[model samples]
Target: MKNRIRDLRTAKGMTQEDLAEIIGVSRQTINAIEKEKFDPSLPTAFKMAQLFELPIEQIFLFEI
Candidate 1:
């Protein structure tokens, strides 16, 4: 999967730590998500979409 997390966070003037706190994850988890090195769980994905005020489809894209 791919995501617009880094771009959106920068656009919102948010740091990885800030977003992680809001979403109840660690900074490393957020980093992994941003880098596409890890896939978020369904609940975490839902939290991300809610936090960003975007649809999951808009934030996340499947590569295959």
Candidate 2:
């Protein structure tokens, strides 16, 4: 999957740690997600969507 995590974070002026704290994950987890090295669980995805006020599809996309 690919994501707009980094762009969104920058747009919101939020650090990885800041997002992690709001979503109850570790900064490394946020980093991994931004790098597309990790995929969040459903609830985590929902929380992230809620935080960004975007639909999940806007943030995450299937590569193929």
What lDDT does the true structure give each of the candidates?
Answer: 0.94, 0.93
lDDT of 2 by residue, 1-64 (tens): 8999999988999999899999999999999999999999999999989989999999999787
Models 1 onward score TM values of 0.95, 0.95
Highest lDDT among the candidates is held by which one?
Answer: 1
lDDT of 2: 0.93
Q: Flag regions of model 1 displaced more than 4 Å.
A: none
> 1-64 in candidate 1: lDDT tens per residue?
9999999999999999999999999999999999999999999999989988999989999888
Winner by TM-score: 1
Model 1 weakest 10-residue run by lDDT: 48-57
Residue pairs clashing in model 1 are none
CA RMSD (A), model 1: 0.6
